[model samples]
Target: MHEWVRRGVGTVAVVLAIVSSAFATPQSLPQTILPGVGSTSWEIRNDGGTDGGPFAGVCDGSPAFGFDDATSASGAGDAYDGAWSVWINGNPFVAPGGLVDVTGTTLLAGPVAMSGLNVWLQYFFSTTHQAARILVILQNPSPVAANVTVQVPINFGSDSNTTVGHTSSGDTTVTTADRWVVTSDGGRATRSIPQSFMDQVLPRWSQQVIRRRCSTVLLETVSVRHSTFRCRARAPARSCFLPASAISPVRAIRLQEQ
Candidate 1:
């Protein structure tokens, strides 16, 4: 399902829709609800503290952005299945034993932690830009290298309904790239990340270390005529082995307008 956020003159509205199956007939449309909140109208579903990662949703208004469910295009069933989760060194980040801590936002989730690895997952929101940010910090105290993989669904519906694209641009100080989704109905989302960390990390590590890990940063976005939504994820510096303890640089995803 998808959640939306709308910012007007002096009001911010959030709406959530849970579509069990995007393909479900109109008669069996997805369930939608307006949750109660204070000035900030966003809520995070913790799934009873099971998955550890929280799924963000609208607590009071309509969906301001659109992100396709991971399984929507692949026909593999619900990718997230209404729950948000993460993996570290190939292990699921959950509660009671996995995620050490977590927090929420008006339109997103934030600060997820896992024990032992000293890795923390944090999120940031930009009301001015209508974006969501994910920061993955890995402080590997162990001698061995740590591998990180983050899998979030990006099902932008069928090709006919949404357009997908990406762009790479930047200078010496910072290298940046963006992936975007645009819905026919005028909704848009974008995700962006800096390439500097990966560039610095690639050369020093052995081929074995480089090949086993995932991208250092990932961002995806979708947009409409005047609005955009972005999701970004960043990791520690690419040169993982050089530092005794490393704090990967920041990666950001943003949702905004054209």
Candidate 2:
């Protein structure tokens, strides 16, 4: 009886290993939740469960943006890892037994609803520029006021260089821009000379610097708790031979009572 039990255990282990290998061998593609409409496109990996977010690739001819969990500025997390979440009432948006429903499209709107927090997130592409506009609304149905912090992630990449920076646009507004420096040799250069103009002037090459801007606007008062926020991110076209990768960073803007 002991020998028979040992043989059965070994057989079960072998079967489990075979099953795991079979499932691991095939890699699935990310779901293109938001298909490319005109010049814009977006995708997400639903199979990743909680870790699923937008894919890191071209979105309307610009670098796609996602979520970053790292708090430090220098420690930028993976751009395509997952979508940003909210901290509500001094707690994470999704509770231990909470539910998250993500549904939307590129043609119209994509909405992510969190039942526990009673928050709705909707995103769409800009018609004028190659950018995404995200709208976050919090409905504080609870008796007490809720404090929420919406964290966004910005990831930009290109064949030449990838860099992101922030600057204040107004008293209550902040702007995040991605800078790309391109040279003739397909590498980043400190200074770019206009090859078209330089070839005629001195037969020398000039590097080109391109900057794209994305803005985040807080529509309602943050102190009040029950309010709305609008974040507009756009990646305008650049005057470079190759398509420049530009993505905006996530900015925390405080809204005033209105």
Candidate 3:
């Protein structure tokens, strides 16, 4: 588990996301949660930009990552999910939002480039899990080998806030999981590699970075936890499976209700 101690968290509203077809130009962003009805819920965006936004959010009834608040800096929501931004050769991949489109259960976003590496995020989701499956499609259209690092800012619970002191935003947690990230409130979320996807490593977490404002640091820790991959010149779009369950149709990842 992360060994640093900083306490903060705030209220996050729940709203249904907008699902749309492909768009030629960028649109606006709608940050909310359609975490399903009753026991199922979700947090995906179809705002025009930041489309297919958050990689993790309220799955089932528990929120493992991300906060749905348009009042935040992003003006739509704050996604603390891992892979928030990708770093190639220490440079971040940035593009104006509005390039997200979800078809059925699969999500496609980006095509951003940094250091001659082009990156696309293909995410799969289920109604019962926080983050289902993530396929980071990497290709060097400019033909360059790049050291790719998935920059992830983790939160045990996005909804875990308190008023005990002058601290209230990005609240700290009080438990551990061998395979998942759990909060004292019984909320859970975790990341792992799929057995079917070979040559892929597990994800790495920060043992010493602050909770919300992760300015700089490598995503991988010393332990066997974090994930990073390499891209050769003109390589095919590689598939990296960020699994939630043990291959149950890539179903039930992210946050599942107890």
Q: Global lDDT of each model?
A: 0.24, 0.24, 0.28
Better of 2 and 3 by lDDT: 3
Q: Candidate 3's C-alpha lDDT?
A: 0.28
Identify the leading candidate in terms of TM-score.
3
**What digit string (tens of lDDT, one per residue) describes model 2 on residues 148-236?**
33433323212233321211222222222211122211232222211011110111112211111111222110000001111211221
Per-model TM-score on C-alpha atoms: 0.35, 0.33, 0.41
Tens-digit lDDT track of model 3 for 83-133 = 233334334344335445556555556666544444554445444333245
Of the pair 1 and 2, which is ahead by TM-score?
Answer: 1
| Order of models, best lDDT first | 3, 1, 2
Instruction: Report the alpha-carbon TM-score of model 1 versus the true structure.
Output: 0.35
Model 3 regions lying over 4 Å from their true place: 1-28, 31-39, 44-97, 128-131, 142-144, 156-181, 185-200, 204-258
